[model samples]
Target: MPQQPNCFHAFQQDVSAIKLPARFTFPFYYQPHPLAEIAAEQLQQTLLTNNNWQHNFGLNADDDPDSAVGKMFGILVVQDQQGQLGYLSAFSGKVADTNALPGFVPPVFDMLSKDSFFKDDLAIITKVSNEYKQALQQPLYSQLQRQVSEQNQAFDKALAQFKGDASERKAQRKQQRAQAKQTLSEQDYLAFEQQLSQASVIDKLKLRDLKVLWQQRIQATQQSLDSVEAEIQSLAKTRRKLSNRLQKRLFSQYRFLNNLGERKDLNDIFAETPFKVPPAGAGECAAPKLLQYAFEQALAPICMAEFWWGRSPKSEIRRHKHYYPSCYSKCQPILGHMLEGLALDENPLLINPGKDKHLAIVYEDNDMVVVNKPSGLLSVPGKNIDDSVYSRIKRQYPQATGPLIVHRLDMSTSGLMVLALTSRANKALQRQFVERSVNKNYIAEVTGIVEADEGEITLPLTLDIDDRPRQKVCFDTGKPAHTIYKVMQRTATTTRLSMYPKTGRTHQLRVHCAHPQGLNMAIVGDEHYGTKADRLRLHAEYLQIKHPITQKVLSFKVAAEF
Candidate 1:
């Protein structure tokens, strides 16, 4: 604290959030002009008034407006130095009053605007463009559906063929057994063998002993057949999972590409995949997660097909699995196969309320948590019975409290997820994210050959029924999900990329990457977002945050390849 108590009363400012809450606390994260030089008139005077910077603005580092956005010019905020009290903070006017006190700047009010100022431009595409895009979309979506249909047909055909073949083979085996039993009747066998052995000096051992050996061999053969059947059942289960995943991926890829062709703007949505054949060294978990991540990421671009009953939070969640038993009313035969493949989870399934339920968390802290969930994974269990990554993680680590989520990640996009463990920590971390205090980065491989080495993408996203679960890149309906993507590496087969999702959104990265005006390409391997690949190539590369317990800035990075 300054020993001199020669300052006036509290001075302040008012600020507001733009379309998507641009930044919360302005002065804190603002960087200033390099202190290497200052204006001649304000040089010495600036030195003298250096200590008073914190008095006007809430931050204390040497900063200016030249190098960055919130430099020297902003509404001034004032408060008692010793008091640990202050408002949530607001923005002041841009104009400053020079003739006023040394710390006097502009009068301020309201941290956030009472309303948003965006005027959405939801102009439908031209007939020509619309028709062109539809031509591409219909084929792909239709193909995906066909793949599933054909798959079912093939399975049915194979099953029928197998059953017929099994019946024929079983009949043959039954005939052979019967013939062998008849030919080896005890009376005929004993008499014939005795006559033939009369000439041999040493007849074989006793017939009773031989009969016992034959019975043992028959039992062993039956056991062998049982083991073979069990093995076939296990293999069948594995094949079904693989087939289902593949079909899902193919559909996701087509959906992303079809959406891309419909655009007429900045970048084209790409349709190339970015995965190399599975390397020899991929471990079990690594392979599955990678494949899962790719599918999830691709799915991220696709808007959830089912909404309204999609995302539901805890304060508004409920129990599931209702039951209404009636007296003497039962369908015993039908109930026999009811519980076929319902896997048991620790928690009962919960239903979602809106599109927000499946938002993924990409980053987390003591008070907040991030998730990179699936289109199906709820952000938080809708009802007590619903199972989401949020609920699952918290349950896994009971000691950590306050699983408050600050921002949302697309459920399908494989990216950074964050969370806070406590309310205080949540507030602090939220400020950091809101102020653009954290540094985040990602990697996305689109379908096309992007010529740009580095570029910024600015597109607005809005909710559209046509974009079911997918955010349409309309000027008016959506908030800005800015992304700066660079072509990291390219192959004749695929293109690799690095990206940074500037703002968190329901499906920002996928939609942005696939914007027609931009890349005009789908993120390869992103079945939900763009082109479905073996997996979603999008991965959260880095995250920076102020540690809740340490009170120091901390960073976390995940490799794109991993």
Candidate 2:
């Protein structure tokens, strides 16, 4: 394998004391190894000082909004052929509208290069679109189109008038026949009826002639219109064919390599997934580019991590300098092949964190009961696991008739949960939830200090179609979610908050705190939106509701373990 110039970066600080990771990174999850963290910090410094290129990341006050965007940067720790330790850096997608930047790994395939076929095909498509637009502006074509519209309108008016006049004449003839029948002989009456029939025959011939005249006029105009449209249609057809061919060619060129020197294109990687076709930017993420370069140069891959930089995007919740997991939609299938045969870090999600935990019962009655749920326990049974709050309660009370659980908490969230013992109690408690009559409060510790004491967040949320179970802020096709928060305690490094959610959307509280438009801080231990920790640092603390049988307000409180 050949080496690229000036891409591999050796560590600046002394890392002799740090222990290297035993296995490579699991791209979709896992905390950053210490060596990877050091490499990331060095790259971030380069981003601040390097001036060879210009891109508006919206970090400055005067940056242009149209061009500004945040980027995901990744670092891959590797060992060169001589056993020299260093790392490779890469940015997701393109940087400064190009892929060839100093101190970064090159793209798997550069579509923007001067000699690439993509540029030539794109130019051809653009020319066809321009010609199509110009053809529509031709004077002859415009005139012919107006003539078609006017001719149709004229024919409708003439036909309507003719029918109306014929109706009037028939009514007058009927009255005259009745009068003649009363005053004249039968023979005279028959002659009068014959005269009325002749008039009707003449009107029918006139109506037929009118239709023929309009048809001829319309046909003459349409012929001219069709001649002009033929060229436009031809251009449109060519554009579609060219665009499809260009896209297919581009996907084929984006070939990725694994540790064993195996290769697969974008189309081949995504063929077995639910989305039959590879999404728009499938092979261009930071993780794939870094790993591809490492393999190409025979650099032994050790560990990797990706982080967000600059201003956050409008939809996804991204904070500056926050470590994030690889996206599931685009990179999961590709990495699944790229990481083949590498003894990677074990996926933490597959292991049950609640296997030895116990359910603590707080209060009990014939109608309802309150219990303190432990963190790392599922509120309901999941696809792979059957042990949850519902399953545990069912085992304890075999005589319980209705569904044991009324509401829910996220599997990572620990708090107080109320259960119903009877069908009537379940119905009554469920109604209160639907009507937003139940009052609840949550306590959480975030990663940063919050300046404001209290505030409200009104952001709409929807699921990322490609990434399941993860919600993003979407104004277009999302449900309304509202949350109110007050700061309870603040330290130099963290802020403890009490949050009240008005709506019960999935991940409402976590997203609200993490999103830039909301609190701009993630819950300290939230693995989904924040960095991983000992626990999620979020707990359901207080809940108040009306009793089903007693009709009296019942309030319950549980202190957080953290």
Candidate 3:
């Protein structure tokens, strides 16, 4: 086993046949280069056979709560100062309760080191947190709280009882005055009225006195409770302040060097973005770790890739041995600065994928039109590109009125789409979609063979706030997404499925198919959740809706190209 300087592992096999990538990888989105793939394979072999460390990735038993989590690992192919090719490996965040590993690159900043100021400040914060907890459990505090609660309850009961008795006495006096008016002289009636008035005044005075007495008693008890609670609150405030200060200091310590040797801390990187303060784990991803180390050693970066290494987490979809792009929230801004001087690959997202493809109108009527949308075409105009189904339809139907698109398929999805040519049709079609009266059937080829013939997926979904446009299964703050799928055909390695989405959520079918709780198979060529290929193997093959003007049922179907 040969190793280069500063945790760079030289390739054990001959890579003379492998061609180097012409440009460095665009970290936010890319397909792994050949060299990067080979490096990853070598690293994976090490993870399987080596005994240098131990950490349970929850691969064997997923139900065990004590198991450690799986992590993302990255590989960066580089040329050393002597022009020798090798790769540097790194894991996101920490591994096995530490940031250092023998074969992998070190973190840009290690806050866990014994001499680091983060450890000392964290200790103080922990101490304050303990003190706050202890204060909550104090017997005196508990006693005072109980006293306040009891005093308030007793005052309410007494006040209600006194008011009830006074009302009864007043009713009795009114009845006596009414009877005396018929049986006594005017003089006697007048004296009786005076007596009744005097009795009512006395009752009012007593009620006021009672309220004042209870208010004083409750105030004394509440003052004791407040005093005890103040200590607990002070400790809590101190702990929060200490943690924030420590976090800020730690962020400042993570100084990243670009290819040009320019340095910027995490704060400076995220200062202009929507998240002015850097997120909790901003510079802790595998890509940044790999890039930082490469620049530090003055190595020329060739290409890079990152992959997941174990069991999928509960909230997000992650597959073992699956390659993924760097996250947008944490790595995008940081890598934008780090890879500045390097000649990088062109961003695929910026190019109009549907430019050369033709949009064929399969059916057209007075009120509606159906078209066969090709793969890699957007359902509507995107932020950067104007060539889409909606845009092309506008050119075709210049006199069309109101919102034309009834519903949408993913940009990567190819097949049938219905567009309304009149305002009345648009409203009716949209209402049907909202009512779930319109039926849509999609055909997709997934990576693995599914055992079940047909079933319903009921996973709730919400946006992964950190990663834009990516949806995750979140039970806490998610909308219910339901999908019914049936196995159409099966091969040794892949399965064809007919997906009927009960609810039209953004990426509903894709997420359901890829999630562990759903089909547990990623759709073929699904770049967001699965591996990338020439195109996503998902198409809206069938659509059923009633005509708005005629009230007649209409159906449309288009065969998939693949």
Candidate 4:
């Protein structure tokens, strides 16, 4: 095997003279570098040639080669110490229980190394966990649990006996009253009932003594259970405190560096949040590890890419060989701190320019206007983006009044949107929406086949506050959202559906289509709930509403291009 390049000086003079890549690798999102693609192709070819490589990727020869289960491979374009451009590959998580590969860069932290501090910390954690387990298995603890269980059974039996006795006595008293009723007048019967009640008082006194005795037994048993439970709880608390202390110490040891060479420990990274810092290996994702190595080796990072090379996991949707952006839950905050000094490419999706912007006006009247909105355009002006449908329409009809936008489509969803021209029209249209008199239809292509021709989905939804812009099913504190869908077509791997939303909660259609309890499949190209595609495969296809000023029913339909 060829030896890997140690430094830039190790490269040939010709290779060293090549100019650096024009753009720095985007920290969050990126297209693969041409060289990186070549490298990945080479890696794939190499794996095909070597059966051992398949095993390294956790692929069995017997398994289907096209299975979606896969690993994520990242290639970073970098200049060596001699200023020679080359690519270094790394895989997310681990490959075959190892981080070191012949041509790949090493992990930032080697937790697997026997001599590493992480090993010692892990050992301590293991010991603590075993201690907790052993404490539970102790004879005294087992006896206490058994005693609680036995006493509970006894208490139940005693209570049942008391209830049975009471019922029997009441039955006998009722029979006596019935027999006496035949010989007595109504007034006489009432007097006899008083006598029967007086006789029952003695039985009540004896039952009270029995009740007190059982209550005392239950109380004693409960006290014993509480004492044992307290001891068990104390042990758990001690273990947790010890674990946390060790974790804090471990996290403090992991210090990361940005492009500027400024350092921040893992503890510092999570200081503002309510949670304590995660353990030593937190934030050691493929992207961060690659960047850290590049910075340390004085490499100039150019374009980079990360693509899945194995089967997708059960929880998230990841197609084999597809490039995915860094995860927001884990990588966002860390990259925010790490990419401080690098000049980043302008995010094209966020930029909005004035003038020459076209709004496809489908229909317009004195009271309202209907326009077709393209995918990747916002419905209204946001904090950072102002060139939305509302903004464009406002410029076109500057004299228009009230909130022009009557409803919204997600930025990635293309479709027809209706805007009111005046406050009266807006109020009328808003009322129609509130009363669900306005009917809207959306066309979407989802990831799976639809067995059912049509179905109704009702899921309450609320914004995931911690992860902004993403909505989740929240039964406890969510507004009810309903969607009625009909299958329009079905392909081998996808289904096309027409959806009618009863309530216009944000991302209601997307969530309804993606949630397991609902459709159990995601709309194709839905980036938030599904995998990223060229665009979200959803379009607002039709709308029907009563014209506000004219009081005439109006309907509009647009064909979905997809």
Each prediction's total of clashing residue pairs, residues at least 3 apart in sequence or on different chains, is: 90, 0, 0, 10
Which stretches in model 4 have alpha-carbon errors above 4 Å?
Answer: 1-22, 46-61, 64-69, 130-211, 273-276, 279-281, 352-373, 379-383, 386-408, 416-440, 445-537, 543-556
**Scored by Cα lDDT, where does model 4 land?**
0.75
| Tens-place lDDT digits, model 3, residues 290-399 | 99988887889999999999888887888889898899989899999999999999988899999999999988988999999999899999989999999999998999
Q: Rate the local accuracy (lDDT) of all candidates.
A: 0.42, 0.89, 0.91, 0.75
Alpha carbon deviation, residue 183, candidate 4 (Å): 14
Query: Model 1, which residues run further than 4 Å from truth?
Result: 1-379, 382-385
* Candidate number achieving the greatest TM-score relative to the actual structure: 3
- Model 1 worst lDDT window (10 residues): 301-310
Q: Which stretches of candidate 3 lie over 4 Å from their true place?
A: 1-4, 58-68, 139-213, 357-373, 389-408, 415-438, 542-562
Those runs of model 2 whose alpha carbons end farther than 4 Å from true positions after fitting are 1-5, 61-66, 127-242, 363-369, 397-406, 419-428, 466-468, 491-493, 547-553
Candidates ranked by lDDT: 3, 2, 4, 1
| lDDT at 378, model 3 | 93
Q: What is the TM-score of each candidate against the true structure?
A: 0.35, 0.79, 0.86, 0.68
The lDDT, on a scale of 0 to 1, for candidate 2 is 0.89
Model 1 root mean square deviation, Cα atoms: 31.3
Better of 3 and 4 by lDDT: 3
* Residue 149 error, candidate 3, Å: 4.9
Per-residue lDDT over 1-562 for candidate 4, one digit per residue giving the tens place of the 0 to 100 score: 3443542222222343344556666645555556656656655655567555344343566676444246777767776555456666677666766766655667766667787776777677687678778767778777766776777788678768877987898898899899989889999999999998986887778678867876787677678767767766777887788778767766676577788998776778778555545433466567777777778777777766777765544333355566666765556666777788888766654565422445699999888999998887888887788778998889999989998988888888888999999999999999999899988899999999989999999889888653356778877888999899999999999999999998999989888888767787888888677777788999999999999988898999988878
